[model samples]
Target chain A: MDIFLTLFINGLSEGALIFLVSSGLAIILGLMGVVNFAHGALFVWGGYAYVWIYQMTNSFILGILAAMLIVFILGIIFEKFFVSRLYGNAPAQILITLGLNIVFIEIIRLIWGNTPIAIKKPDFISGTTIINGVTISHYRILLIIIGISVLIIVNYILKNSKTGMVIRAGVQRSDMVQALGINIRLYFTIVFAAGAALAGLGGALYAPLAGNVISTAGANNQILAFIAIVIGGLGNFSGTAKASFLLGLMNAFVAWFIPSFAVVTNVLVMAIVLAFKPEGLFSEGRKSILRLAVKK
Target chain B: MKSLREHIQRDFSKNVIIALSVLLIALLIFPKFSSYTMLNLLTRIFVISVFAMSYDILRGYMGFINLGHAVYFGGGAYVAGILYNKLGTTIPVFILSIAVVVLYSVICALVMGKLSFKKGTSVFAAAMLTLALAEVVRNIAESWRDVTNGTDGLIFKVPSILSNRIFFYYFSLIFLIVMFIILRKFILSPTGRVIIAIRENEQRAEFLGFRIENYKLIAILVSGVSAGLAGLVFGTFNRFANTELLSITYSTNALLYTLIGGTGTLYGGIVGSIVVNVFQNMLLNLRSIHPIFERWLIFLGILYIAVILFMPKGIVGTLRHFIENRKVKSDNEKSSKTEKAPGE
Candidate 1:
C-alpha cells in the first residue's frame, strides 16, 4: 500500500512535468503545423537559466520568471527568423529545427560545460508531509498544484480568450482564420512563444525535483514529450494530460517493479499506441495527429 | 537529322559510359597513388555513399523522408558483428551475415511501412513514428547487454583476408562499385519510374491504377537492403559494432549527405558523402591546431541550415540545374541562329 501510494504521487508529479512540456509542443504543432524539434532545447535552456538565476538571486520565483522570459524571447526569434520561412515545408522545418536543436545543445554545452547542474529545493518546500501513513514530499505537492493551476489557466484562456479562440480556430483552419482577418502568422508566432514559455516553466519546475539538469536532458524530455503527444492525440490538451499521467504512473510503477524495463516502457507504450490507434487515443475521427507537407 | 529523343538518348548513354570508365579507373588507381590514411578515408566515403544513395531512393525518388534510416544501417552492423563474433568471420559466415542483414532490414522496413503508410497518415507522423521506433531500437541496443554488450560495444576480428588495409579497402571499393551499379540499374527500371511518379503525385498515380503503397514498399526494401550491405561493409571495416551506429545522428548524417548531394540524382549521394566526409575529416585534423575545432558539431549544424536555405537541391542538383539551363539556352540560340541565317 505504501509503495503504491508513493508510486501514485511520483506518477502524478512526473505526469505534471510531462504535461508542462507536451502541452506547449501540442499547441505549436496544432496551430502552426511545425514540429519544432528545438522545443526540447528551449526546455534545457530554461533549466539552465533557472539554475543560474537561482544561484545568483536565491529566489526560485525570480529564477522561474527569468527562465520563462529568456526562452519566450528565444522562441520569438526562432519563429520569426527560422520557422516562419519554412511554414509549408515539413522536411525543411524538420531539418531546420533539428539543426537549431544541435546548435542550442552545443551552446548549452559551451556555457554550462559538460557537468550536470543541480538546483536545491526552496526552504519552504524542502520537507515531506505524511497523510494516511504515506509520506509525500512538499515539492511534489507544489508541482501538482502548479501543474493543475497552469492547466486550468491555459484551458480557461483557450476556452474564453480571443487570442485563444484565434489559436484554436487557426489549428482547425488557418485559411479560414486568415479570411476572418486575423494575422494567422502573428498568432502562430505568439502561440509558439507561449508554448516555449510553458516548456521553460516545465524545465524550471522540474529541475528541483529531478535534482540536476544535463544538456541532454532536453533531448530526453523532448522524446518523452513526443511520446506523450503521440499517445494522447496531438494537439488535444485533455488527452495530453491524461496520457502524461498514465505514462508517468506506468513509468513510476515499472521503475519500482521491473527496473530493467523502465527505459523501454515509454517507447513501448508509444509503439503499442501507434499500432493500435495511429490517430491517438484522444483523436475524434480520421484526423491525422500530424499533417505532413501541406500541398499548396 | 535524328529526332531530339534519339539525340538525348545517345548523349545519355555516352555520358554513362564515360562516367563508368572514369569510376573504374579511379577505383583501380586510387590506392596506388594515395597514402594509407587517404585510402581508408576514401573507403569510408564509398561505404557512406552507398548508404546515402539508398537513402536517396526513398527521400529523392519516393519523396519519403525517413528520419530513422540508421535503424537499418545499425541493424546491419550489429547483425554482422554478432555473426562474425560467433562464426569466426569465415567467407561463408560473412556471406551469410550480409544475407541475414538484408533480410532483417527488409522485415524492419516492411513493419515501418505498414505502420506509417496507412490511408490518412501524414509524412510528419511517419517520420516521428520512425524516429520513435529507432530510439526504441537504440534503447534495446543499449540494454540488451548479452547480445550488444551494452555501451561497451562489440569489438571482434574479421577474417585474415580482410585484415590487410589495402586488401580491405579494395574489397569495400569493389563492393561499393557493384552496389552502385545495381542501384543505378534499379533506379532506371520500370519500377523506379513508377516510384518517381508516386513522388511527383501520389493521388494521380493512385488514380492511374498504380499501387502506390506497394511501390513505396519495394523502394524501401531496396533501400534497406543496400543500406544493410553498406553497414556490413562498415562493420567489417571498423571491426566493431556499437550503439552509436543506431543513433539518430547517423540517420541525420545520411539525410544531410543525401540532401547536400541532391535528391533523386543517383550520383548526388556520392558527391554529398564525399564532401561531408572530407569536410569532417578536415575539421578533425584541424582539432590539433585549435581546441575550438572540437566544436565541429556547431559548424555541421550551421552547414545544415545553410544547405536548407541556399542549396536545397544540393551541389549536384544545383550543378545539374545550371547545366540544363545552359543547354536549353544554347539550344534556343542555335535554333535562332539557323532561322536568321536562312532568312539572310
Candidate 2:
C-alpha cells in the first residue's frame, strides 16, 4: 500500500512535468504545423537560467520568473526569425529545428561547460510531509499544485478567451480563420511563443527535482515529449495530459521493476500506440485523418 | 544522321562515361599520392557516400524521410564487429556478417515501414516513429551488456589485408563505385520512373494504377541493403562498432550530407560526403589555431540553416540546374535563329 501510494505521487508529479513541456509542444504542432524540435532547448535554457539567477539573487521566485522571461523572449525571436520562414515546408522545418536544437545545446555547453550543475530546492519547499503512512516532499506537492493550476489556466484560456478561440479555430480550419480576419500569422507567433514559455516553465519547475541540468537535458526530455504528444494524439491537449500521466505512471512502475528498461518503455509504448492508433487517441475523425490513413 | 533526341542521348552517355572514368582514375591513384591519413579520410568519405546515396533512394526518390536510418548502419557495424570478434575474420565470416546485416536491415525496414507507411501515417508521424524505433535500438544496445558491452563499445580485428590503409581504401572505393553504378542503374530503370512519379505525386501515381506501397517497400529494402553494406565497410575500416553508430547524430549526419549534396541527384551523395568530411577534418585540424574551433557543432548547425534557406537544391543540384538552364537557352536561341534564316 505504501509503495503504491509513493508511486502514485511519483507518477503524478512526473506526469505534471511532462505535461508542462508536451502540452506546449502539442498545442504548437496543432496550430502551427511545426514540430518544434528545439522545444526541449527552451526547457534546458529555463533550468540553466533558474540556476544562474537563483545563485545570484537567492530567490526562487525571481529565478523562475527570470528563466521564464528569457526563454519567452528567445522563443519569440526564434518564431519570428527562424520558424516563420519555413511555414509550409515540412522537411525544411525538421532540418532547421534539428539544427537549432544542436545550436542551443552547444550554446548551453559553452555557457555552463560539459559538467552538470545541481540546484538546491527552495528553503520553503525543502521539507517533507507525511500523509498517513506515505511520505511526500513539499516540493512534490508544490509541483502538483503548479501543474494543476497551469492545466486549469491553459484549459480556461483555450476555452474562454478570444485569442484561444482563434487558436482553436485556426487549428480546425486555418483558411476559415484567415477569412475571419484574425491575423492568423500573429496568432501562430503567439501560439509558438506561448508554447515555448510553457516549456521554459516546465524546465524551471523540474530543475530542483532533476537535481542537475546538463546540455543533454533538452534532447532527453524532447524524446519523452515526443512520445507523450504522439501517444496523446499529435494536436490534442487533453489527450497529451492524460497520456503524460499514464506514461509517467508506467515509467515509475517500470523503473521500480526493471531499471534497465525504464528508458525504453516510453518508446515501446509509443510504438504500440502508433501501431494501434495512428491518428492518436483523442483526434476527431476528420477527413484529413482519413486521408492520412487511406492510400488515395 | 540521328534525330536530335538520339544525338542528345548519345552525348549524355558519352559525358557520363567520361566523368565516371575520370573519377575512377582519381580514386585509383589517390592513395599513391596522398598520406595515410588522407587515404583513411577518403575511405571514410566513400563509405559515408554509399550510406548517403542509399538514404537518398528513400528520401529523394520515395519522399519518405526516414530519420532513423542509422539503425541499419549500426546494425551492420555491430553484426560485423561481433562476428569478427567471435568467429575470427575468415572470408566466410565476413560474407556471413554482411548477409546478416543486410537481412537485419530489411527486416527492420519491413516492420518500420508497415507501422509508418500504413494508410494514414503523416510525414511527421513516420519520422517520429523512426526516431522512436532508433532510440529503442540504442537503448537495447546500451543495456545488452553481454553482447554490445554496454556503451564501452566493441573493438575487433578485421582480415590481415584490411589492416593496411591502402588496401582498405581501395576496397571501400571499389565497393562505393559498384554500389553507385547499381543504384544509378536502378534509378534509370522503369521501376525507378514509377518511384520518381510517386515522389512527384503519390495520389496521382496510385490513381495511375501503380502499387505505391510495394514500390516504396522495394526502395526502402534497396536503401537498407546498400546502407548495411556501407556500415559493414565502415566497421571493417574502424574496427569498432559502438552505440554512437546507432544514434540520432549519425542519422542526422546522413541527412545533412544528402541534403547538402542535393537530394534527387545520384552524385549528390558523393559531393556532399566529400564536402562535409573534408570540412569536418579541417575543423578538427584547426583546434590548435583557436579554442573556438572546438565549437564546430555550432558552425554545422549554422550550415544546416543556411543550406535550407538559400541552397535547398544543394551544390550538385544547383550546378546541374544552372547548366541545364544555359543549355535550354542556347537551344531556344538556335531554334529562333534557324527559323529567322528560313523566313529571310
Candidate 3:
C-alpha cells in the first residue's frame, strides 16, 4: 500500500514534469502551426543557464529568472530569424528545428563539458515528508505544486488574456487573423518566446528532481514530450495534461511493479493511443491541411 | 541558323549539356582529389544521401512527414545483420532484410492509416504516432536481448562483400546510380503522379475516386523498402547495428536533406544529401582548428533556422526559379521584337 502511494505521487510528479515541458510545445504548435523541434534545446538552454547563474549568484530564484529570460530572448530570435520563413513548410521547419536542437545540445557540451551538473534543491523543499504512512519526497511535492500552478496560470492566460485570445484566433485561421489588421507573425513570435520561457521554467524546476542536467537528457525529454503531445492530441491543452499524467503514472507504476516494462510503457501508451485514438483524447474540429499532405 | 547564345536559350538540350558537363567534371575529379581521409568523409556522405533519398519518396514525393522513418532503416539493419550472422549470407541477406522491412512497414502503415484516417489527425498527430511507435520498436529491440544482442549492440567481422576500399566505393556509386534511375522512373510514372496529386489535395483525390488510404499505404511501403535497402548497406559498411541507427535523429537528418535540397524536384534528394554531407564535413574539420567549434551542432541548428527563414525553396528550387525567370524574360523580349516587326 505504501509502495502504491509512493508510486502514485512519483508518477504524478513525473507527469507534471512531462506536462511542464510539453505544454509549451503544444501551445507553440497550436498557435504558430510551426513544429519547433528545437523546443527541447530551449529547455536545455534554460537548465544550463540556470546552472551558470546559480554558480554565479548562489540564488536559485535569480538563476531561474535569468535563465528563463535568456531562453525566451533566444526563442524570440529563433522565431524572428528562422521560424518566420518556415510558416507553411513543415519539412523545413522540422529540419531547421532539429538542427537547432543539436546545436543547443552541443553548445552545452562545449560550455559545461560532458560532466553532468546537479542543482541543489532549496532547504525548504529538501528531505522527505511522511504522508499517510508513505514517505513522499518533499522536492517532488514542490515540483507538482509548481507544475500545477503554472498550468493554471497558462490556462488563465489563454482563457482570459487578450493576447491568448489572439493566439486562439490565429490558430483557427492565420490568414484571417492577419486580415484583421493584426500581425499574425508577431503573435507567432511571442507565443514561441512564451513557450520557450515555459520550457525553461520546467527545466529549472526539473533540475532538482533529475539530479543532473546532461546535454542529451534535454533532447531525450524533448522526444518524450513529442510522444506526450501525440498521445494527448497536439494543440489541445487538456489533452496534453491528461496524456502527461497517464504517461507519468504508467511509467512510475510499471517501473515499480516491473522494472523491465518501464521503458516500454511510453511506447506502449503511444501505440495504444495511435491505435485507438489517433486524433488524441481531446481532439476537436477538422484536421489541418498539412495533414492532408499525407495521402491518407 | 541561330547563334550559340540564341540556340542555347531556345533549347533545353543546352541546359542539360551544361548541367551534365558540370556533374561529369565533379564526379571525375571527386575520387582522385579525395584521399583516404576524404574518401571516408565522402562515403559517409553518400550513405546519408542515399538515406535522404529513401526518405524523399515519402516526404518529398508523397508529402508524408513520417517521424518514424528510421524504423524501416533500423529494421533493415537488424534483420540483415541477424540473417548474415545466422546464414553467413552477404547481399542476398540484404535483399531479404529489405523485403521483410517492407512487409513490416506496410502492415504498420495500414493499421496507422486506418486509425488516423480522419481529418483532424493529419499532420503532427500522425507523425507523432509513427515516432512513438518507432520508439517502442527501439525499446523492444533493446529488450529482446536474444535476437538484438540488447543495448550492447551486435558486432561481426566485416563480410567479404567488397573488402577493398575502391571496390566498396565503386559498389556504393553503382548502387546509388541504379537506385536513382529506378526512383526517377517511379517518380515519372502514373502512380507517382497520383502520389503527388494526393499531396496537393487529398479531398480532391478522394473525390476523383482514388483509394487514398491504399495509395498512402503503398507509398509508405515503397519508402520502407528503400529505407531498408539503405540501412542494409549502412550496416554492411559499419559492420554493426545498434538502437541509435533506429532513432529519431536519423529520421531528422533525412528530413533535413529533403528540405534543404527542395522537395518535389527530381534531383532534390541528391542535392540536399550532398549539401548536408559537405556542411557536416566542414564542421567536423573546423572542430580541429578551434576546440570550441566542437559545438558545431549549434551552428547547424542556427543554419537550419537561416534556411527555413530565407531559403524555403532550397538550393535546387532557387536555381529552377532563376532559370524560369530567365526563360520568361527571353520570351518577353521575343514577343516585343515580334510586335515591333509589324510587316512580319
- DockQ, per model, reads 0.62, 0.72, 0.55
Pitting candidate 1 against candidate 3, the one with the higher lDDT is 1
Better of 1 and 3 by DockQ: 1
iRMSD (1 decimal) for each model: 1.5, 1.1, 2.8
lDDT of 2: 0.84
Alpha-carbon lDDT, every model: 0.85, 0.84, 0.76
Docking class of 1: medium
lDDT of 1 by residue, B173-217 (tens): 888789887887787777888999999999999999999888888
Model 3: per-residue Cα lDDT over B22-68, one tens digit each: 97578656776678777666666666666778788888787778788
Rank the candidate models, highest DockQ first: 2, 1, 3
In angstroms, the error of model 3 at B92 is 5.1
Chain B TM-score list for all models: 0.94, 0.94, 0.87
What fnat does each of the candidate structures reach? 0.55, 0.70, 0.81
Clashing pairs in 1: none
Candidate 1 fnat reads 0.55
Q: With candidate 1 superimposed using the best TM-score fit, by how many Å does residue B224's alpha carbon deviate from the native?
A: 1.4
Which pairs clash in model 3? A99-B301, A100-B301, A103-B297, A103-B298, A287-B119, A287-B120
